[model samples]
Target chain A: MFLWIIQRDLLLAMRRRADVLTTLFFFIIVVSLFPLGVGPEMNMLRTMAPGVVWVAALLASMLSLGRMFSSDHADGTLEQMLLSPQSLSLLVLGKALAHWLVTGVPLVLMAPVLGIQYDLSTDALLVLTASLLLGTPVLSLIGAIGAALTLGLRGGGVLVSLLVLPLYIPVLIFGAGAVEASAAGLGAGAHMSLLGAFLLASLVLAPWTAAVSLRISME
Target chain B: MAINWFKYSSPASFYSLAGKMIPFFSVAAAVLFVVGLYIGFFVAPTDFQQGEAYRIIFIHVPAAWLSMFLYVIMAMWSGIGLAFNTRLSSMVATAIAPTGAMFTFLALWTGALWGKPMWGTWWVWDARLTSELILLFLYIGFMSLQAAIDDPRRADKAGAMIALVGVVNVPIIYFSVKWWNTLHQGASVSLTQSPKMASTMLTGMLIMSLACWMYAIAVILIRTRAIILERERHTVWVGQLQEATQ
Candidate 1:
């Protein structure tokens, strides 16, 4: 059931490539704008890079949350899914993973290139990428709950951010902290472990919450 | 004889019960506020380090405690409402949000007032302050989420789910002072250990906190009564109550 949902969503996303590209471009543009805004000072940009990149990733992930269930909901597929005997949580988990695959993976892939623009050392750049690799999935997972709750509500896009962003703080702190720690010659292990922990915890928890939220919203 | 606890779970019965209790709590809160402030402003000795500015702890500590305390209570009511589909519990949860948010804003404001005098700045990115700010955001989010949904039942359940999810942060906020050695000071009063402050200061702060509790209960009960009428307006009991009032 999980793989089927992922495959189905991937195919749908592939058919409308612009939707996926838009989120990636948003991540890139937001990251690129920082250096321009802050001036081209290497020392400052290097320090600012981790936080800037992580925050952009957070926003970009949030922007795509609206797409998680709205289309299916509008077309009445969501009602069908809810009626299905299979657990709704599994279906939501698959959608969250696909969301990460489409939106989160690109940012993880792009962070290193952006890090270079900030003059981040090679080791810091690697840490930035590795941190995003673990961290962005958690964003998608937690965001799914927000998206599900605000499903079909007016002003849902803004509402989702208000509901979800505070919850995202620990992820933002540790995600950016990993890169900063690595830059300072401190091992990124502790921060990385915390991010991994967040990813694992959200993986277990968010889908179920989102599933319950879907039922509430749909009813 | 066993008490029928579920009797007041009905909105109609709870409405009158809440009305009867409000005056007692309101008077207690008023009296406690006077006593707590009297001791807080006059009787408590001036801190050697902070001088007279430290007296804001009387309000700050209570507001901060209630902000976190009410969130837990709100979530507990919300959780009960969700699991058992109880209407009164959900209404109580709704009523608690504004007061909780007020207390949160009070804590932040008083912390700022206290901070300006003691720390030489109005705010810092200390763990406790940041977490408290997040707590305010969580309260706002809960209220807004419920406001956006048109169906009251859907609003209740959805808000309840988010409330339960956000409950994890309360513990983090409570422990943030210990977890990171931030600029914010540790607890002056704790359950396990004796308080770290002078006895009079402790007494005044406790009384102030009790005042806050009474104030919160009085306010929440009144709000919940209003909510009951608004939500149950179509019912026969509400219609009869309106006629009786007229």
Candidate 2:
């Protein structure tokens, strides 16, 4: 079921590759601006890279979060899913998994390339990728709950940020910390472990709440 | 005797009870604040390191404690409300947000004042301080989300989910920020320089925390009463009460 949902989402995304690429471009542009805003001093840019990349990813993912349920909710597919005998949590999981795959994986893939722009060492770039790879799932998972809750509301795009951004801070902290630690020659292992723990916790917990949120919003 | 827990779950019953309770807590909070301040300003020996500036601890620490405490409490109330579908519990959670936000602001402002004199900076990315700042953001997020949603019931459920999620992340954020801070700056903040707490200083802090607790109860009760009136306005009792007041 999960694989099917992910495949469907990917197929749909492929049909509208522009939207997916827009997200990637948004992230890339946001991260690139920092070097221009704060002069292209190699040392300073390298130091700032972790926070900049994490924050841009956060903002970029937030833009995409609105789409998580809005498309289905608008077309009435969400209501039908809620009414189905198949567990809503699994469906919710499938959707969240698809969101992570479509949005998060791309960001993870793109981050190492951006890291190199800031002159991140090979080790730092590797850690940044590992961190986001673990951390972004947590974002999609938690964002799913926010997306589910805010479905069909006016100005929901902003509302999803208001709901999810604070929740994103932990992931940001650990994610960025891992990269920064690696840049400083400290092992990123502990921070990566923590990020992985967050991923696991959010995985177990978020879908159930998101399912409940879908029911409430639909009602 | 089996206790009927559901009795006060009704807003009307809870309303009258909270009204009766507010005054007692208000008086207690006022008295404790006076006593706490007296001890903090006069009785507690001036810090050898920070001198009079350290007295901000009385307000800062209590506000900081209340800020974190209230989020957990708010989350618990929200979780209970969501799980049990109890309207009053959710209302209590909503009422707690503004107060929690106020405490978070108070903590930040006081930390700024304290930090200025002690650390010679208005703000530093100290682990605890940054975590508190994010906490302020969380409270704002909770209140904003509630305000954005029109249906009060839906708002309540949504707010509850955010609060529950926030509770889970708050610790992770704090620990990670702490790790990040320590990795960057070794022990720079005055609070880290550990002045041995004189007994009188501890007493003042305890008193202030209690005062904040009482103050929180009184304010929340009053706010909850207002919430009950707004929500239950369509009901006969509220309508008749409005008529009687006029």
Give the candidate number with the greatest TM-score. 1
What TM-score against the true fold does each predicted structure earn? Answer: 0.99, 0.93
lDDT of 1 by residue, A119-190 (tens): 988999889999999999999999999999999999999999999999999999999999888878899999
lDDT per residue for candidate 1 within B1-246, as digits (tens), equals 999989999999999999999999999999999999999999999999899999999999999999999999999999999999999999999999999999999999999999998999999999999999999999999999999999999999999999999999899989999999999999889999988898999999999999999999999999999888889888888888854458
Give the per-residue lDDT of model 2 (tens digit) for A152-183.
88888888888888778879988999988877
How do the residues B106-133 of candidate 2 rate in per-residue lDDT, one tens digit apiece?
9889979988877888987766777777
Say what the interface RMSD of candidate 2 is.
1.2
What candidate 1 gets wrong by more than 4 Å, as runs, is B242-245
TM-score of 1: 0.99
Q: Model 1: DockQ against the native?
A: 0.93
